[model samples]
Target: MTQQEKNFEGSLKIRLYNTKSREVELFQPYFAPRVGIYSCGMTVYGYAHVGHIRTYTNSDVLRRLLEYAGYQVTQVMNVTDVGHMTSDEDAGEDKLELGARREGKTPWEIAEFYEDHFFSTIAECNITRPEVISRATEHIGEQIGLVKRLEDNGYTYKTDVGVIFDTSKFGRYAEFARLDLEGQEAGARVAVDDQRRNPQDFALWITNQPNHIMQWNSPWGRGFPGWHIECSAMAMRYLGDQVDIHTGGIDHIPVHHTNEIAQSECATGRQYVKYWFHSAFLNVDGRKMSKSLNNLYTLDDVRARGYSPLALRYLFLNGFYRRDMNFTWEALESAQRGLARLWGACAELPAPTGVVIPGFIEKFESAISNDLNTMNALAVVSGVLETKGPPESKASTIYKMDEVFGLDLANSRTRLSDFWRLRGLRPEHKMQAESMADKREKARKNKNFSEADRLRDRINNMGFQVEDTPQGPKIVPMFDFDFAAMRKPVCGHCGVDEKTGC
Candidate 1:
């Protein structure tokens, strides 16, 4: 065992809600201090939405907390640049093909454009990039090799369409998901193929499609690998047979992950994964985010509204990862306000002495270790802020907590100043407000209440508000400030404000 593992072996054991057993359990890697995590990444067919942001942020927290607990983690996330069909059952056109058709571009072009946007978006939210980024298109040879092995193991059968994994051959196929096979109806989604063995049978390698933009020579024929096989193959390729943790959104539990378990175990005859972690969905305005409702808000949309991406990340931290989170304009505004306060408080503190209170650290670590309950951890942050203590000590403690929160609180002064500037508070206006606030402070101290009220009104008129703190008076932009002129929607294509009829 490594020194890090040896140190933390007898310490607190991290608990996580494992989907395989549907309960919270103590987590321990097969090899001490060494962990391999496979995260289900985006398909790169479209722009990522807020739901994607929430899922990745939660995964980032998981990885960060594990590292904080002295685990040597290697995280792998796959990019599905090809072979993800619109339908979950391996029917319909490929999503990348559909995106290519939507815009006047090739499938390869669509993949690169959206993949760039997806990573950039997550980076802005301070989500840590995985150690290994595996692409399905680049690993086609490995996928084909995995399918060939399944065929040799007598777990696959060929049909007119493609090579399918016969679920009947694996008796424990439905055990992971606890699915009712008898109640399942065939042909309910896509048209049922007459030669298919069972409804649960999924494609391993698709053939007989001549017009597919991307295809390769496999044992079955000249076609692409199925969606489920791509993840199983690429995960095993990087993480090896002794994979520790697998994470994805909860929607993946039924079809995609279930198929992965069946095919992976049937081929290798070993347990595929130890812990299965799934994040819950994020909703908008108390309804599911959908294109029909036009509520598919992206990080770009959040920036267009003049809110920092970190503010959205802060909102995500307020809820448990296992429960659905509802997003609204008011909630986002409140989160932005709360984050501004945090940044402001950090700015007012003195230089850190590199000393942290042990009680606060213990409470914070305990909260995050309990299945990554960031909500409770955030409460401990509030307690630290409220407790009477030295300024440097509080600063030091909050900065240590930020190691997992990833909020960049160490540079709070610069970030707070930048946040106000991005919110349309001009430097000259900010100076003017500060001057007025200073005069108001003097007037209040001298018992000139009427003069203090007058100065406060003048500061408010300049599109800022003065908040009295123990440190001093702080100048902040008002939430209802008259900055709508600067917030008009811009034409995404031409980069012109919509007010000009672009």
Candidate 2:
């Protein structure tokens, strides 16, 4: 290993929320020198809601920070296109079917459309993509393979409704649910499903009817894989029988992920997951933003209401991931104004005097190392902003902290209105991006368009794309960037040149 990789993991502590512990514990991967992660991705029959963003971006940031901290991470995300039903019980219509009816398209079409949108939103939020993109439909064979393993192990039983997993066989099935044993036996909590053998048993596979538009033949007959089964099968197929981490929303704790554990552990006879990370809900005006409540917000909803996608991400980071965050347009506007200053802070980066603020940096690292205490870590970033130091050190600290905040702070001159105000540029990020355009005027005037285009390529690599139109080359940000620190070269098309004329 090179110095970058080697020096990265010298007993450095990271705390993660373990569902098993139900509290933050020091994060220790099952294997040293390698890490495996599995995140429950969206059920792609519809556009992702704020609820979706909560978990997806939370896990996304975690994975990125993990990599930034020097651990090699293999992350897998399941694209849940099949097997999810309207009811957690084995009886309702498939979620895909419901989505198709609502949208007047085939389930496959709905999946494709919404899946694309999901990816776009996540990427816009600056979440990194996983290494292995596993689709539940693509892993039918693997699901069947796992189901067979459970069947052979005597943990599965066929019934009139479907191939149900016998939770009685596992006996320890409800442990992950964190329910009191007495309350579970009395059915005192939660929506009840009497059909589920022991109030905890769940389906491994659901037999499909001939009229169903999305059914496939399986070892158990024509059926769809169970919702929980798909995640388990896809996760194990990619990460192995045991995984370092499994992440999803807090909503999944009661049924989806808990059942996943019962079935996965029943099949493999081993610990299913070491760490379970879940993000709390993002409330709108002190009320939970939920589909049933008709309070969900779409990306367009947020934009029309006049907030960037990132302000919402910032709002989330203010409160810890394990705690609920309330959203008000006023709050988001404040975040926007605050982040605008963040860009100016980056633009103002000065040289490091090599005077280490050990006291402050230690507190910051301590926050993150403690179960990714992002709220506190954010406090550290704020403190860094307040420190009287060389711009280089302050800027360097902000960049290191972005590894956890995922705020793109180092490159968000575009996101900050103050940045625009300070630079005397237009409010729109694209306008600021033009100021960061690369200079190729010398090469272009020399008619070495090749060199000029190469310069354009370099600018694009820095996340600005230029279009040569009759009006001249218009530069736009492919996304946000730290414009002040950007090496804005002279515009070739605009005839701006360094040391020579276009």
- lDDT of each candidate versus the true structure: 0.87, 0.74
For model 1, how does the per-residue alpha-carbon lDDT over 106-132 read when each residue is reduced to its tens digit?
999999999999999999999999999
TM-score of 2: 0.78
lDDT of 2 by residue, 1-502 (tens): 4454445567557878788778878676776556899988989987787767777778877886677666789999989998777765566788888999998999999888988999888877777888998888889999999989999989887776678888778777667886665565445543666556666667788885555688778777887887788899988988899999998888898888878888889888899999998888788889988778787877767665555677777777776788888777788778766665566576556544445466677887788778777788888887888878776777766777787778887666555643243333333344434543435655676888888877676566545678877666777544344444444454334323333434
Question: How many Å off is the CA of 267 in candidate 2?
Answer: 1.1
Worst 10 residues of 1 by lDDT: 489-498
Q: Cα lDDT for residue 494, model 1?
A: 26
Runs in model 2 lying further than 4 Å from the true structure: 1-11, 180-196, 350-357, 417-502
Output the number of the lDDT-best candidate. 1
| Model 1, runs deviating above 4 Å | 1-8, 88-91, 432-456, 467-474, 484-502
Q: What TM-score, computed on C-alpha atoms, does each candidate reach?
A: 0.90, 0.78
